[model samples]
Target chain A: MPQGQPAVVPTDGLTTRQRRNRPLLVLHTGEMKGKSTAAFGLALRGWNQGWSIGVFQFVKSAKWKVGEENAFRALGRLHEQTGEGGPVEWHKMGEGWSWSRKQGTEEDHAAAAREGWQEIARRLSAEQHGLYVLDEFTYPLHWGWIDVDEVVTALRERPGHQHVVITGRYAPQALVDAADLVVEMTKVKHPMDAGQKGQKGIEW
Target chain B: MPQGQPAVVPTDGLTTRQRRNRPLLVLHTGEMKGKSTAAFGLALRGWNQGWSIGVFQFVKSAKWKVGEENAFRALGRLHEQTGEGGPVEWHKMGEGWSWSRKQGTEEDHAAAAREGWQEIARRLSAEQHGLYVLDEFTYPLHWGWIDVDEVVTALRERPGHQHVVITGRYAPQALVDAADLVVEMTKVKHPMDAGQKGQKGIEW
Candidate 1:
């Protein structure tokens, strides 16, 4: 890993450039902060490459406004106005999905999650985005709201050069197994360990 | 960590709001890729909160153009034009520092790193930026180019609500002890593990 070089170079028949350019399914999981933050950071890189950036927040409330949303919205506007970067589309679980606007019981939430995954599946099939950020998406799978097998199948069979990054705690073993890159954010120390509360800007 | 709530509420006497608003010193370290990316994403949040963002690249070459640098520069320009967010300052080791423009021996690079830390120390004393992203800064300390004790002392005694985040592998133990929050990004899987080389936009 010195100088950002890969530790092992495989004997795969593909050329170096071809192997390098392959789209990735990256997963960030663990009981720590920065899962979604890292995913959004990857989206920033994707956007700079003029890649269509689509973010789907699965668990966070629609009313809650994270800083990345504001900044990305600004980037989207920049793309529209000046065409400097790529287009950006952000969707939340309940409100962003057309079929899941009304808030309801646990069953309703499950239905919403299912519908959200369905929409993502459709987008993946259509190759709508160059990078798809499924933020906090693991909760749905962890809670058994969505079938892990179906999700993995869709991702494994996804078309085109679309890269997908999923972030949340308790990522399913199946999902981790299917991912090309998986990072576990381990909390070595935290302000909360000393009783400090979360702050604005730092913690969404 | 349920619903972003602190697990423990300390009896340290500070009000909840006061404790919550306290600035943080965060460190991201370990053998993984998302260290700098997560730091930049945190900077994005800080920016939305009108926090001045300062980025210093310590290990990367001045000739290398990272996507975060380009995106944050755009953000800095956006802040200047519309006053929507806080200002951003980006500095690299050799080129960004006025004293070390010419490429020379390893000693020169070490001197530049020292100068970079010195400038950051001055800015910390002045409470310059709301969020200081010491990108890949641990390399200097790990390589013995910069003194870890000095960095820890300066960070501990820094005044105001200026948050600092250092990202790289091999973070010193003293710095980790001084940090309010620390995350270690562990690699479960990587494309490189499968013999894939790094690609533009995704790797950079």
Candidate 2:
């Protein structure tokens, strides 16, 4: 194939196998938004299309979330169907003690987290993915927990066939500008917005 | 064009103009979710790429939403950019009525609305587009306003290089089955769950 030549699909429909190799970019959201579950939904889709993908969850403060369980199971399902190695990968910004909720005393710790995010960014940019979702990523930038510009630059430089999504409220305009798609959710009518409490299966 | 052919993609990646053309699927979400805004964003992108395209927003109840100013503004922008008749097309679906905080029942209103939505859907499917987004469309089927199977059939039968996006929660399994891309919105933790109000511009 010529350099950066996307599969030369003529006007005709793609053969079943030709359709399988297209790369994707997915943004796994962080914060109170539902990034994890959505990421799984897209992964199931990528799996259906016969694409091998890598999934990373960037978490600094929390460990072992209850909500991400379904996604892991779905990843297991994808592996079962394809017999590929693990499809889901997890990254904690710091070692347990460093990633703890306590405030960092010096800039060194903060710098380290930035480097870690950059390293991840480098990996994502180089690897052409069937799908990549940055789960709950924007919150760190807003709170000074991560370097924002580096991530955006890396995303811009990422493989164009890779379809990327970022989900978070109050996201930086630069990030939104970089993304091909953005979904800003509103509360026009919600049960929780009213006085009712969230029930387990539906809310969680 | 070959039978069942997707839109023609040049083998050299260049159209007659020498610029590359990427087969795009643009999905504009309505229903208080940033449908028009997202669509406009993509349109701006397509313009940047010098793409020949058509844009349509297919929904019955949303022709004019006074409560949401940004939503209306988003529609306006897309309308202007697409030029003339509609960036937002009106289609109908039978007859219906909705009771409200301000206004009460009205006749032919539901029919007119459905007509508006159907009109948009028809125009979008028949036309050749690099990207097409059906904005604020998910709830119609859930509410028995539109036929789910027919919509899927129309999209599958289209002869072009098209990437379509349908955004909303509770997407029908039939739709999911037909889709190369599927995303569901999950509300993990929201400020509203704790009685916090939505911040201005952020929520809008």
Candidate 3:
């Protein structure tokens, strides 16, 4: 053992680090991307894990954008074949965040939101439901339509076993910091930028 | 020893007459009245009876009407709680009765209708789904946006199990005659006819 070469250090038996925790998936940024697919995939994981679920969308519009409808359409085929309700509970919230010009005596200033956070509070308070997905929920907070801290506090109060997903572009830093896992999807490419516009099935 | 009353009808079980056999539920007026509720209840009954269902709507807009949005909102809660994904499918046939308006100098009337029906037919084909709920789908047919005979033939060709629901008033005689159940919700009383405008959650 007196050779010129130095002896190698001995390694101990591996303890633990490879172990994984089923994370609470938080997705943000980009539309018409594969977010819904990923979210629905997470729903499947929740279902498989025997977790009851609730899906809620914020900042609603007349346009039938992705939210509850997409889940129903996407999961309908799955439910039929599997004899299971793949996703559970669907809720969509709306906000009046546009400008309407005055007609006559009445000033049609639709910039400020009318209905405050009452309905949202009710929904959040009834938060016993598991695996909650708050879709497009960040916008209202971004635009100051709702109190973000209040919602974050409620979310933190939820059980550790319960998974929650908050989806929207530019999610509040408070929400991101509160989350156990955060996924930010940087837009690599988009059709809208080129004026191609969104088509049904593909976008909706 | 029986009384004059025609032998007491066996009230124990549902008779053929009580069952909605491939019935067509039509809601013409643009409002979420008791009619929408009744239609869902009727559909729920059919769902319990183990029928393959089809839900479709031909609309001039993908945009949600105030009344329709409300109807779906009320229904949304119930649907989330217990919907098993019946044969109903929601559809939006791209806007307008004709393409002449959008086509600019040239008109693509036949092309537009062909495009619409082709898409609709594809969904209704036996290979794909069953139980068609044509939500507010009658107006296009009535307005000559879609062909009446084509609509008639589609329903007839639809399997007996494929219960069709057409919602709207002033339904063509062909549709009226083809349907198994015809319910007309006459305007006995309405707030709109009066000076009072619609309030949120109630009217819409």
TM-score of chain A of 2: 0.64
lDDT against the true structure, per candidate, is 0.87, 0.43, 0.45
What would the per-residue lDDT of candidate 2 be over residues A123-191, giving only the tens digit for each residue? 676764545555556666666777578777777777645545455555776665555334444322222
Tens digits of per-residue lDDT, candidate 1, A126-170, equal 999999999999999999999999999999999999999999999
Deviation of model 3 at A95, angstroms: 6.6
Ranked by lDDT from best down, the candidates are 1, 3, 2
State residue A123's C-alpha deviation in candidate 3, in Å: 5.7
Model 2 stretches astray by more than 4 angstroms: A1-36, A77-86, A92-112, B1-204
lDDT of 1: 0.87
For candidate 2, write residues B130-181 as lDDT tens digits.
Answer: 4454555666655666778878787777655554555554566677666543
Per-residue alpha-carbon lDDT of candidate 1 for residues B138-167, written as tens digits (9 for 90 to 100): 998999999999999999999998899999
Q: Whose DockQ is greatest here?
A: 1
User: How well is each residue in A1-204 modelled by candidate 3, as lDDT tens digits?
Assistant: 011222332232322221122224354433323334335434444543334556665555524444335434434334445544433555543433222222234322123222323443454566554466666777777876667798788667644445666667667778767764444433322323322333222233
Ranking by TM-score: 1, 2, 3
For all predicted structures, in order, the TM-scores are 0.94, 0.41, 0.38
Error of 3 at A40 (Å): 2.9
**Window of ten residues with lowest summed lDDT in model 2 chain B:** B92-101
Q: Which ranges of candidate 1 are over 4 A from the true structure? A: A1-12, A95-107, B1-11, B94-107
Q: Which ten residues in a row have the lowest lDDT in candidate 3 chain A?
A: A1-10
